[model samples]
Target: MKVPAPNDDRKGGRVPRWLRILLPAVLIVVWLALAGVGGPYFGRVSEVSSNDQASYLPASADATQVANLQAKFSGSDAVPAIVVYERSSGLTKDDLAAITDDTKDIADLPGVHGDVSPPIASKDGKAAEVFVPFADDSDLDTNVAGLRDHLSTSTPDGVTSYVTGPAGFTADLVAAFGGIDGILLAVALAAVFLILVVVYRSPLLPILVLATSMFGLCVALLVVWWLAKWGAVQLNGQVQGILFILVIGAATDYSLLYVSRYREALRDEQSRWRATWIAIRGAFGPIVASAGTVIVGLLCLLFSDLNSNKALGPVASIGIVFAFLAAMTLLPSLLLAFGRAAFWPVRPKFGSEHPQVVGPHAKGLWARVAGWIRRAPRIIWVVCTIALLLGATGVLQLKADGVPQSDLILGHSDARDGQQVLADHFPGGSGSPALVVGPASELQPMADVLLNHDGVSSVAVVAKDSPSGTAPVTADGVQPVGAPGSPPPEPTTVDGDVMLQATLSDPADSDAAEATVRSLRTDLYKVDDGILVGGVTAVAIDSNDASIHDRNTIIPIVLVVILLILMLLLRAILAPVILVLSVVVSFAASLGVSAYVFDHVFGFPGADPAVPLYGFVFLVALGIDYNIFLMTRVREETQLHGTRQGILRGLAVTGGVITSAGLVLASTFAALGVIPILFLAQIAFIVAFGVLVDTLIVRSLLVPALSYDIGRAIWWPSKLWRTDAAILASDSDPERLVEEQIDAIGAGGRPSHHHEHLHQGDREHPAP
Candidate 1:
């Protein structure tokens, strides 16, 4: 199949030599300035990013309510770090003495709150647990490190110590995300560069592509940082990491499309200026359509109930915007400056035969695929659909309800280790408790309900007059720790409200604790509708529930939105429906594969509910990108060639470039695995694998075959249906006739290019 010629009129007429040179120079300088200004914000993202779980909860969530009231109860926001000292042989007198000394030292550390609870020895006599409240404003990682250093230096010789709890976990999480700036970016860029070098087989071309992508990311970061700083959006490590990879991957993908068009154009036009303009016009529609689909789908996250998911929508959309801008402007300018040399050793010469020639028929790999489709379009789509349906059965195995907070981070976690020790000795939820806030007059009633649950180990109400700031509440009433008949201190009250803390029998992050918190809320809400139950367990429950809500709400919205976008872009209802179905099937298959791998191979406890939501948004939005690329070209080709011939021509022309773009995107997302976060790793694998599926099977085989079997009806309700322009354009050329015969034989002995009668409208004027 021969590529269509570039008309000077279609590209806004010929560009003058001086303007071409001057335009590229201005673009280069502007992009370099953007990169220079935004580069320094890389390592400093943490200044605006947060990892706090409660901070991401929905405003209406019980945990969010309790967290907001925490200052009223405690006078300051504090994160508790539980320090556990253990000995296999059981605790000795010296060990007990050393534990006391360690507590005092811990209290003296910077960022450590003044109220350090005395070390409480476990009944088993093998372990001691101490609660150290760290001010929320402190540098968590630094404080945790300092505490660890102090304990290691001052603890008894035979005893071991670990820093764990909300604070410890938060510190570990912060440290994990710390890799995003340096290691994650390095790996993603390195992978993209290497892939580009191999794909294009040119060093200079890869460098140029990398520069465009990096510039996009740098400028995107600059804009997003100020937005985050100004409170227009929330920034978190997960969102930040995703933004980086998305920009680089997306920018490169768009660049690949433009570069493919440029190289193809270079062969047809002698002047680089004309070639660049033609390439830009040809590449513009598909690139913009592709980016628009992704951006709209991501924006659907705004409907999500969870703050984290909501925040990600605009954050990622901003990245995609920059990616689109860079590809359309920066990449085109750079390519124009270098012209044919951009491809270097494999540069295309003007008027050279299309480089991928195979025999006199021009039957390349994609041509072969088209021929295979033509032979049995029905059977090809049927078999592929059946296989995909079978693979989708594994979705039943997907455990996306939630995973424990401790498991959120992949490798070793001192907090996780300490939780186990704490559970083996003291109440699992000692330092972190399920807090209940209600009217001050009803504090005892709430405390009694908590005490009634088997999961509740103890209950305490905040008492301002007590030395420990809290007094125990038993079944009878508030119990004084002082002499008998002495008056029990009044429970602390703020705005006629009081807080009650219930220590649990299970670890704060465990499922049992979450269940307990749920049950407590159910019981307490019956007593008083305004009562709030929250803390570590409540945060987990609320976060998981919100994620589930988001998955249900946002997934459907994203699909509907993308479906509409596809319909508008393709200008056909039936085609958009089919494309949406194909992508949905592809997404299900990807999730199914992930489910089996996570359950059997990785032995992951489960997945975050948001995982499927994120996977759906990315896969369907991104997976449909290849279809957009293919079908738009197919539609364009159909306008010139007949529908049947256009399907083949479009598939043949687009196959290599689309596949390269998919592989590039897949590799970039796969780079997310290097961060060692379970959420990122799952997303990395799902998106990477799904993109390849879209490229290799869905876009290449199923969509094409289905469209071919359906014929011009694929453009239903559009004027292109029932029209054939191939004869009017090339019927007089003898070489075209010979090529048609060759293509017919290549396509399963099908009859060569038979023109159809034009549709009812404009039979006198053939399609241009």
Candidate 2:
């Protein structure tokens, strides 16, 4: 009496059927519980999220240091909202009286800091601007929205009121990201659902796949929310939106891969439990490798100097972790519970042929792809590589210096409009000033340095003795703003330092303003090394410079890190090198195409430097996933069949699944286009297009053809390089081995017992 092998017995035949059922039930219940808990955290994310520029700056940045020290000098951290009232004609008495009344009322509003600046007439007198300061702890967007409503009602007729400044811009930015938790996510899910329903052609299967993704996202969010709350990580609107899309796309892709394997296994295995186990074993390597690659690649962002970039690294990695977990555990459990019935109209039948596979031959579009690859491997790779290289030439057009804050929000923006009005009549940096902090004794010298700069329209020092918050400073010194006999107002000193606010002639968000601030800071630092420059313009300059530094520093590190991961996963130096190069080429091409689109089509302002950094992280990391999916299968199949045949078989078998995964990822990322922010939109296009390129061209044509041409040497330095022929011969003949194992199970006998019988018959009459 021979016992069946471990593989046969483990699939409910040996293990109790009750345990199998219980396991899936438990998993489903756990995931449902996790989803329930995480679903509510969406709205609560703002509790921990911040858009404060200083918070995201590098610690050592002069702006960051000044931001910290400047906070100590003030009672509260305040953002100024510049309210500009304009009319074609000079302001009438009624308009001036209305503006004065509005200022008084604004000072009483919640979150208002100090006194609202009395309406200061613009040089043209056609416009008057009021500066309203909002405290740091306030809900800035809410307060600004309320203020807008108030202005609409309080302002005199024929005078249009526009809010523009740091506070106004922040409100617009926050409002732009407002859709992330609702519309962005809903659209992404709906798109994925439609795609899944079409791909599986089964109502129940799509639900299971979506459930796995939703639950994965929920759990990942739950963890991230707490992590952010505890200050273990930082959360922002941009990062939050990416996290939701990335997790959903990644989980669904992993689920699809597993579903495909489970469906294939169901054709041979009699028991659902057995098929699920077999599917898990078959899918485990690629799923883990793919997720690991993405996780490690994202984590490479830790090297970034910008806190936002560094924060995204772990935040997104955590999302990937849960996505992998849900795909492996929750999805498998759902499929196991549903069994063959999950497919509904098109169920996988035991002992029936896999639909994509015809008797003794693979037949389909993928097969044709394989045939074409076999016909001209070198031509296919060379042509595809050159085309990608040509597309990559567009990388020269990418303008990643940085974008003005006014352009940060797409579509209508009152703040941006107000900035234009203010620039037309008043010093462009009317409400927002570049702040300089230095030794109290050096205040006069720092103020002199600021006054002498070409960019400086005026300079003032905070003076405690003045009724107004500040006293004007000329090249000579701080000029008293009081009555003639009053002693010169003393500059307010905090610790040993005094603050000077420099007004710029250019718009605070303009490149000219940044250049001016850069020069002023350079000159002031020479006068007093302790002098620190910060404010809206300085923050922008510093942030952009840091982002550029991060882009340069982190891109190479990410590349090196991902290359090493590929090397370990493939266990071949040459293949990893080739894959890294392929993805880098693919990324460049995607960026090139995006640059053209942004310039000629979208007419977008130059990209933020971080845009390319983010694109590289997502494209290369995610791009390598498809290659991993294909090459791992090739490596697996190569162990059974020779390398050349293995490449063909691997491409044919994995084509539909990998392509579907790529489409799903692309679609989800494309959903980000709905958000209307430049950075996310650019990223959405680059990564989505890059994935398709990898799926259609690189993975389908280039990688397989190149690998086929290289043959077994693709696995160079691996022991398989020397032992390929022997491994191919003694792999128990994969086709015969499967038949023998099935027969042994049917006979209730050991695989050893039926091995010779199957081998002898296979030798006598081989498969086509």
Candidate 3:
């Protein structure tokens, strides 16, 4: 249960201290190096997405197939920007004049190409769109940001211009993230202060939690950054927000354990250092087990079919691991140096038995709930089952989709305006779907064929060229274009293939896009040799296509993981079985409720692509964590007392802490909903709902009753546990055994030796 101590050869905690500083320094140096070597920063930014599975298509072909394909897209690589003009006050002659001037101005901006539409007024003359083509397709996000900034500055009264397309979506995400950096820091500080004030009853302690968690977050972020730079793993912008939450919440959980126990040791008559060490030993096992459950749950994300989902799981797991480490080591070190004043003003007496979870009269609310369960356990089960099943109806209606970039921004955002422009004039698929790369020879005919297809709104063809002919000159400037349509020419390719560019009416990330893509996927290869489709849409479809397989694999995989962990810890097969089953029920309830809220009430554009998988992994896994906390207490108590009494005792002891943790976690996710972004908000709602289900229904009520009903069969055939000789004398006092932390500030150092001695006495015989 204890952390492995540092060796005598290294003392004064210098090793860990140096590690904390040196690690980040090494990572930053490496990141700058990679950034320097990765060609233009645009190419480097693009490289971040190059390996993402969701950013790619299904691997039905090799490099040769892809090479054979991209040769066709010569003319269309420079996707046009939709220049939107809106006059909510109604477009006047001046509006048109301003729009014309803006379009002319953009024609001269860096990277602009092709013919732009004049400001065509809406039926009500409130809107118009102009088209500006990009001179080159590289560094799309940066280019868009520049364009937006310029246009925003130059826009005149009674008119506005929105530059939107695939490029525009990327631009908006980058812009929204501008504010996110500060918000994340604020969120971390707020969560820590809140936790400290509630649990420790002091401002100083919460500040410590924040500082400790920030240290853990810094390590986690540094690692993620290193991995991102080194091509080890990738993180999306969405990942950044969730990562902040995970690191803070998880690290705070550990901080709570360490500080609370540290205070208990101080009250037990132990010196600061000794009490800190004992607290580590006492708390280490439970925290590790708790964190293990979370880690295992997050690791289940590896089984998720989506790259974003996969990336998120490991990122969260890594944060939790680092937090766990800080809890065991760094936190103990600081608390050892802190002492009795860590809990000031309202100290619970040590060496004196406080009230147990079940009071003498058994008058508390928890006892009453236990009595109801014991009186009609089966009926309670049925009622819970019915309620859960009803909640699960929402899950059955679960809907999911890939979201557009504009979906995240707040109102009146230029990015959203751009998206609206693109949506109105161009097909949504002009931006994100995977491309079907063919040859220049294939492109002209393919565009012709694609333009005629059902989902297709337009097509542009390109061919390969090599010092082929005089480049066509335009007002935009003469740069490069593949030869006119003989298998869209590539700098390097044979005569058989060309690129076909097609745009769809559906949003690049929507189900409609997926459906049309499904149709295209079937017809694409049939046309000729060296034909392929690849793009963001292509990848999203692949992700959606893989959902069935992914879920199939994940269900059994998660079940097995849970079963094994529970069996090892409980030494009983049946207990783990029920535990897993109960968790499954809670998970179903989470999904059902989310489905109703997401699909019916709020009518979200779509559930996050990774929601189902995350829900399963988090709910089932964390659900078991509560089961472990409650059941372990119950089992320990049951060994001495009867089953019903043990149930009441265990519930009384662990319920409050479990509820608090759940509330924190749920609140964190709920906070995501407040973010204007549709995808993040939906993800937040579902996760919060899942956590609530796990903590309230599954953990507090169902687990204890189920344990009682199962009887000795719960630990069947495990004679080792049945023997009183094997286990410690049961004492059901999780709260009293560890001190309830009360922090006070502005003292020279720790509490006096007399109080320290009393705290030490509490540690030796923890029941008091």
Candidate 4:
């Protein structure tokens, strides 16, 4: 009985190409359907940060009050503009009237919040804050920016208005994305295109490269959307943006290894289909192995204690798998159909017997650099070790923040202007930061100490105040649930509870802001035993704690997962172990460098809490990818040549491909430096630079030297290695071997003349 290999043609003859062409199409269609059906569901779950977290705690509202408040301060639309007016002299009747007119205009704006605060002329009349709220679904930035610009240039005579608070932050976000983000995207695109063009050597090739990656990205996001809507995942806009770049850049990289080899096959065979099969067959082990390593790395995110990290891992893994699927199936089918003709005007002959050295021409400047390292591998290792050590010194200095965007409008911005006015009249906290008031007994002494804190500028004790407002109580009121005697409810009172404005010493993004929060908490715990230290900063700290806790847990889990996968793929105990170790070292080195670049070089607000975590994941996972690519060559060498000679030859053949992919990946990532969101751009640079180093320095030199040093011990008594020994004894015909793919010209455009049968079907690229 003949065993059918899905990957290869049994007789090296014609095979139906339906699955190869159609499976990817079906996946893409299914992915699109999933996205359409599931977008809103995931979107709702994603609103946790903006919804449930934003809702009040420790109280249950009656339906009426729930509806009232739901419509009132519900969603993100509440607390729009707290317009402030300032003048040296106390407010005159004219100034007050002018302020009133502006409030009317703001309140009347589309999607404007109901019940605007009356003109709050200051006690001394020199300043006043007018509260203007808006609807949750409103485009706060658009309206606020327009208003701010209008008010800045057209303040009514002596009266000046400034808008502040959440509206201001929203405006800032819009501006940041609009202004610097475009440049970053463009740079990233240019970098990716340039790298792909140089590597693939065709203008059309880079577009295909990106298209394949984009297809992967779209499918991964669709899966995430499906799972997220059903409450299986969680995401935020930042995650979306980050995933976009990661999937595209990463998928392209994964394809590079296979495609480059395919092109090489074409050059040797001269028959496009023949070379395509050869390329596909030859690349099977290394490509799958490399992908498995990446998948394992991404799966590590599943262990994230943070729901975000956990979700991120699965989503990313989907991307890798789909990309792998696309490469192995979609790419192969396309190549088979087009053949060498895809290369068009150039057939990629490169002479009958190309120079063996891969010298200075298309070989890149790195080959010369590698040659230098090969001559003095020990010295190279010493220098690199020292350099990486120095780079890593900055890791110790890394700090974490939950919300780290620079989201503040200019002095003339609507929100900023509104905020300045509010601050000048009332306290800054009067605008943002909800006061989570509870009973005196519930908070202990926290209230008293917080009242006296230097940052506390105002106090609002709503407990003793009676609500006689004819302003129509929209209160559906809280349900009198779990009441022992069902005490009759009157006007809500907690006089014993303290409502105090807790100010900060600096901007939250600054070092001092975090320090202030820390110091305040310490002082609260020291004196005010009853206080809970509750508010945005408090939530931030909790989230940060969660982030740190998750990182500590997830890293080990991910590493172990990746190691296990490597063990299976390589079928070697020692080889997989060393590969994991080398990759780990490279990851640590990359993180240290990332910290330096972001925290020291560019001086960002430290690393994004997620930044180091991503560095570890990508560096180790993708680093192993290159390791697999290089190690396959080394393994082939050992099988054909001895350890030393094989290592040298493998490096010579595969080194250029690895370096080209790295350059392209790095450049794509480096483009992030141009992104408006400072942290994201920083992340791009860090990851990009890490990829470059992984290819140019680590894989090209250090790994080869180590492989040379290891010899047969790299495989260390694996059954597969033993089986290979048996194959050596029988001297299996190289051309007759049943590979997973029919040998053909690869993406590298190589050619081959020998005939063979290629019998494979849907099993190679299954749809359902």
Cα-based TM-score, every candidate:
0.93, 0.93, 0.76, 0.75
Task: Summarize candidate 3's per-residue lDDT along 281-395 as a digit string, tens digits.
Answer: 7677667877887888778767765556667778788878877876676666555444455555555444434333443234456656766666676777777878888887776
User: What value does the lDDT take at residue 548 in candidate 1?
Assistant: 93
Better of 3 and 4 by TM-score: 3
lDDT of each: 0.85, 0.85, 0.60, 0.57
Candidate 2 displacement at residue 6 in angstroms: 12
For candidate 4, the per-residue lDDT at 283 reads: 84
Pairs clashing within candidate 1: none
lDDT of 1 by residue, 1-768 (tens): 655455333343455667778998999999999989999999678777888875578878989989999877887788878899999999999888878876777788989976888888999999988888898853877888889888878988989899998899999888888889988889988988888888899989999999999999999999999999899999988999899999998999999888888888887778777887878998899999999999999999998888989999999999999999999999999988888888989988876756322213455588688778867889999999998988899999999988888898899988888888988889888878999999988877888899889999999998878878889999889989677888898888889999998999999889899889889999999889999888989988998899998998888888899989988998888889999999999999999988888888888888989999999999998899999999998887667555766676678788888998888899989989988789999999889988998999999999999988887677777666634433234223222444566677787875434322222111221111
Q: What C-alpha lDDT does candidate 4 achieve relative to the native structure?
A: 0.57
Minimal lDDT window, size 10, model 4: 759-768
lDDT for 719 (candidate 4): 56
Worst 10-residue lDDT window for candidate 3 reads: 736-745
In model 3, the runs with Cα more than 4 Å from the true position are 1-80, 86-143, 153-159, 259-269, 272-274, 359-376, 401-416, 422-434, 439-448, 464-496, 505-513, 528-530, 535-539, 638-646, 720-768
lDDT of 1: 0.85
| Rank list by TM-score | 2, 1, 3, 4
Q: Residue 693 error for model 1, in Å?
A: 0.8
